[model samples]
Target: MKKNLLYVTFVNLVNGFAGIAFIPLALKSLGTEGYGLYSIFVILVSYIYFVEMGVAKYFTRTIAQASNVSEEQKIMRSATGMYIRITLLLFIITPILFFIIPKWVFPTNNHGLVSIIVIFASLDYLLSIPPTIKLTYNLGKEEFEHISKFNLISGLSKHLFLIGSVLIFKSVILLIITVLLRRVFDILYAKKFLKSMPKGSWQPQYAKGEFKKIFSQSIVLSMAQLTQITILSIGTFLINRNFTMKEVGIYKATFDLASKVSFFSNSLGMVVFPRFSSVLKRTEEKISLLNKMPLYYKISWLVYSILFLISLVIIPIIPNILNIQDMELFYLLLYGACLNAHANLSYEFLQADARLKEVIIPSIITLLMMSVIFYLTLDYYSFYAIGISWVLSQVFNSMCMDTMVLRKIRKSSSITTICFNLIISIGVIILYLSLGVY
Candidate 1:
């Protein structure tokens, strides 16, 4: 567990730094409008992968709980077949959606560039399916060291390609092609690693009963994941619809910078999730871990607070560095990120415990509230509308998850932590409002 945590932490740190490094170069090379187009491509590719619908999580839990090697192989075979079908479905459906959705979503943008990006993005995701399934299998097996090593290499190589694409090719089309090729390499690399595992056929082996069982078990998880992705995607969707490509670029860049704070919670959650699933049948052990959740929340809050302070110190200079004009947007989004940092572990625990409705219901409520807030404030606040809605909705969502959902697990201590964090967040908001930045 300690080694896994260390490996995952280092991987996230490297990836985080790479992301931070890429932004400035991308902005310099692509310019704002070009970067906005790249962001659209990235976002669309992520949406395409949503077809997995939490099957990966379901498989991870089942594979982790498997009492024998044969059981594990059975799960892997079923997963491989399911993903193959998903990839084929994507091949058919993605192009049609890409053709229609991009144009509709960004009516004012360049249709030609959109078409190019959509084409490559769809291909990128399709090629990624196999490697993604293999990675999920490794994750279930708690092969964190190998997975992290692969991710480190893959991430470093990807950014190198991305940086090269921008600096050398300076074409969005070439940059996207570079991304597609990276996934091709990832599958080959993943295949080589899979060879070292227990001997079994890696080919697709369709098992209808297994597929139905996994889907039924993970359906609520799928809904929760869909809501989560929609919440993340809606900001980009709204910004693209209402603003210029340049504004979209600025929002995405700032959002990415602010969201780096989440690596702390996300890294910890990833390390703990498999362990949680492995021990799912042990009530006392699970409850003991549940009792420690408040401590986890506190640790997350401390990291968020530290990062928030650091962001304040560096916020002024970021505009000069990134050539962005608005620091207020970063501040608003940072608050949302902080809330996410606090709530992420609790959310993960609920999923690990199969308390899916507790997770999904609050997410649904948050999504509706965020949309309403965006609708009401967009005309008046412009780009700030996205930040405003995100922070406020996150506040409500964090409160719900920490208090209501944690209570379902009989952890009342989390409610106190939630109240304290809420107070701090509210105080920070009031302080930001006093500056009149918005």
Candidate 2:
């Protein structure tokens, strides 16, 4: 687990650096408007994938279960083959949906060439299977170091690849190609890396029925995933409809920076989830998990809080770095980061227990509510309308998750301390806000 998370965190940091590393270049190359158009392409792609319904995510859990009794090699081979077929089908169908969904999902686009590019980019799902299988093995068994090393190798490779591609090719197509290739390479390497581990016979049998059962579950698991996709792109949908692509661009940059930084907590969560799942309902396991969760929450809170504040420091310099001056955009990012931290702490358990519906139902309701509110309020005021709804959405979702999680772990930890901390934090935040952010 140590290696898995450390490697992931390092690579994530690298990816974060790589993004900022290239932003100045991409800013110069794409210009703000072109960058905004590209952001639209990405947002559309994200929306399409989100509508996919969480199948890819279910592979980890199902494959873990399958691995319990099945031979390791057999599990890997069968899972890998099944993953490939489904990913191919998904990639093939994405373009058709890309063309069709915009009719309903959005009014419209320059998706002509970009649609194909996005579709191609989406195919990374196929290449992700082998590493996923390998990683899940480590996760299920608590051998996180193995997974961590693999990620470190691949993440660095990807970072270099991204940087090199941008410097040399400088096209969105090239960037996508680099990303896809890196994933493909990671899967291949991971598959080979697992060869020396426990040996089980490799069976080539199609096992069509078994694979079908797994796939069915995966589809259900994707609902929570789809909720997230909606959240990520829903902002873009509004910005594009009510404002200009340029507004989308500013929003995209703000969200992207926030999302990338926020990704660290995800790794910590990933390492924790399987361990959490592996625990039994006994007081012992709950005690262990409970002791660990707050520590996890504290680590997440501190990391995100520090990063959030640092982003504040960096925001002023970002205009100089990327040559686009929008302080309010960074403000949006900082707010989003705070929300990201709180929301993640709220939902980490939901993912661990495979209770995405617990996570999804609230998120979906809040999303619909926020969307309606934003749409209504946006007519009078634009971005501020979106921000108000965004903050409320996060607050509602976080509180919901917090209430549920605290209930589950209340016997194990200090609710009073948590409540007091929350109250104090809110007071300080309000004071800071009232003082007027510099």
Candidate 3:
């Protein structure tokens, strides 16, 4: 477990550099309008997780519970066939949506090109799923080092290709092709790794009642995932639709920087999930988990504090480094990130306990609130309203998760503490807005 945590942490650290570098290169090469279209394309790809129906997560939990080599192989074989069907279905449906949806959502003049790019990108993402099945299997088996090693290769290749393609071609078509080619390489490496593992069949077959059972369980998780994605992307979507692509570029740039912190939390969550699943059935082990909860929470706060401090120092330099004009959005986004950090730790625990409802229910509520608030304020405030709505929604979500988490763990959390945090968050936002500090 310790080794897996270390490996995943290292992978996130390496991936962070790529993430930081890729944004400026993409923005410089594509320009604002082109980058805005690219942002929509990426958001569309992110939504593909909705189509995935949480089957990848189901694979992790199912395979983790396997008793022996034979059982594990059988689980993998069944999962691979199921995943293939899902991928094929997505490949077909996504392109059709791309054809129909872009016309209504984007400027009519650019619809044709955007549709073509979205189709290609969707196909590329679908093709990447076969390799994902293998990677998820390794995760279930606790082969963290192996997963991290391959991820480094694939991660570096993806960014390098993105940077090279954007620098040379400055074409969205070529940028997506770069992604497709990276997936092709990843597929080859994944297949080679599988061949060296305990043998698993790839012959597609539908097992009796198993698909129904898995889908039933997975759908809840899928919904939770969808809500989470909406929370993350709603601001981007609203900005793109209501404002200029140049404004969208600024918003997404700030978001990308803030998301680096989330990348670390998610990496740690991935490590925790399967390990927690392993001991979930044992009562004594579950108690042990509770006992260590404080330690985990402490560590999480420590990490968040370090990240928050670093952001304070780094955000001012970002505008100069990337040659961006606006740094106001960074203040809003960084505050949102700090608010989310504590809630994310709570989310990880609930997810491990299969209590996904707690995390996602608040997300659904916050989404509705954000949408309404952004709409009501759009005429008067424009993009600035989106920033305020985002921070307010984060506070709402943090309160919901923090309260539920404390109750579940039998930990005492006073109303004074929650109210104090809320007051502080609101006060800080007020200060920023009143002073126009950002």
Candidate 4:
């Protein structure tokens, strides 16, 4: 486990660096307005995530729960078939979205560029569905090190091509082109990997039945996931409406840095989620595993805190280089990530047991809180206010989800765990006030 964990963590670190590497070059070459334009497109592309609608999460847990490789393979095939159908549905919807999204997200003057970008981006998202299902299969099987290496190769290749495009083409159109090519390559790679696996018989009847079962669970999970994605991306959308593209660029820069902290939590969470699903029927094992989660929660907070401090030291030295701000914004994002890790884990824990509806209300409330707060505060407050509201909404949602998760597991809350959380909360508050957070 430690070996795999280290490899996965290293891969995540590489992925994070690869992501951040684009910003400086982009800022320098494209300038704030150009980058902001690109950022809006990127955010718009991310809405495809909402369209994905928790299908991958459902696939991962279901595949992980399969009794054997043959069962896992069948699940994979069924998921692929279901995704093919979903893609076909998107084929009808996507054209309309391409027309509508550009008009909604960008200025009317740049409709041509935005329209082209949305079409390509939407195509990229569709092409990615197959490869993502394969990747989820690997994760469900706990092929951590193998998946990590594959991701490293894919990530490096994509970023290297992107960096070259920055120098040679320096066009957002080319950037979207790179995205389309990368998705094609990823799908080919995933197909090659799946072909190497032992073939399992997948009857059309069985595949149809499996799709229905998975789709039923996915409908609920999709709503929950949509809420989560909305909470994360609402800032960009709101900022685009009320602020300048330059301010949008600035806000996105902060959001990106903060999102890197989330990479740490997700790196571990990805590994643990399948394991939780694997042990769902065994109460003793599940309890034992749940008992160990607080340590991980604490570790997530600790790592994020250290990263926050490092950003303080590093951002000032090269403030203009990466478009980094001072510490307050980072702290807000870090705090949000810390609060969110446990809730995210809880969501996985409950989902592992096939409790899809348990989190629906909390998820809805989270979306509402983030939307209301961000909309109300965007005019009166700085971008950091958006960050703060994000953290607060996450806190409320996390508490609600955590309560349900604990009750479902038949575990009483521990005082020590509660104390650790309070300590972290108080410490963050002090740190925020000291930094003159507004």
**Cα-lDDT of candidate 1:** 0.79
Candidate number with greatest lDDT: 1
As for candidate 2, its clashing pairs are 1-144, 3-148, 4-148, 53-222, 54-222
Cα error of candidate 4 at position 219, Å:
1.0
Question: Across residues 14-66, which tens digit of lDDT does each residue of candidate 4 receive?
Answer: 98898788777776666666677777667767776666667788778877777
- How accurate locally is residue 224 in candidate 3, as Cα lDDT from 0 to 100? 81
lDDT of the candidates, in the order given: 0.79, 0.62, 0.75, 0.71
Candidate 3: deviation at residue 171, Å? 1.1
RMSD of each: 2.2, 3.7, 2.7, 2.9
Q: In model 1, what are the clashing residue pairs, if there are any?
A: none
Candidate 3 CA-lDDT value: 0.75
lDDT of prediction 4: 0.71
lDDT of 2 by residue, 300-393 (tens): 4455555556655666554466444355555654565576565675565677676666877887887897798798888676676776677667
> Where is model 1 poorest over a 10-residue stretch in terms of lDDT?
192-201
Instruction: Evaluate model 2: give its lDDT.
Output: 0.62
